[model samples]
Target: MSLVSPEYIRYFYYGAIVIMIPFIISDLLKKKKEDKIDGTKHFKISVYNILIAIAMMVVLFFLINSNYPS
Candidate 1:
């Protein structure tokens, strides 16, 4: 058996998105109450988290698409 199979890649891709949902939701909820808060730290954190998730997705895509011996 070989590692990094296509099916595993798909699962990793979807898993990353699923894991990010809660963070996204929290970010949205925070935005709704932005008026009450004073700092931009949470916003920055959320953006960073989103960017990291995207990076992971991209990496997974490339890994999955790369040519490898079956």
Candidate 2:
């Protein structure tokens, strides 16, 4: 048996990706209001999170479809 269920992993990844939407929106708004403030850091972090979410989606797909031990 797997230590963690694939369903739970799937939900977690989906939740993580969804939860970042508001933060991204907030960052954009903050950047617009404060022109001098640097937003590249927030953008970079969002990109990193997106990449990780994508990777986790692939992993979750594999885990759900394959018989490999988790």
Worst 10 residues of 1 by lDDT: 35-44
Candidate 2's displacement at residue 35, Å, is 8.7
Best-performing candidate as measured by TM-score: 1
Segments in model 2 whose C-alpha atoms lie over 4 Å from true places: 1-40, 68-70
Per-residue lDDT tens digits for candidate 2, residues 31-68, read 55555475346655555776899999999898899986
Q: Against the hidden reference, what TM-scores do the models get?
A: 0.49, 0.43
Worst lDDT 10-window in candidate 2: 31-40
**Model 1: per-residue Cα lDDT over 4-46, one tens digit each:** 5865887787888899989878867877478347745666666
Evaluated with lDDT, which candidate comes out highest? 1
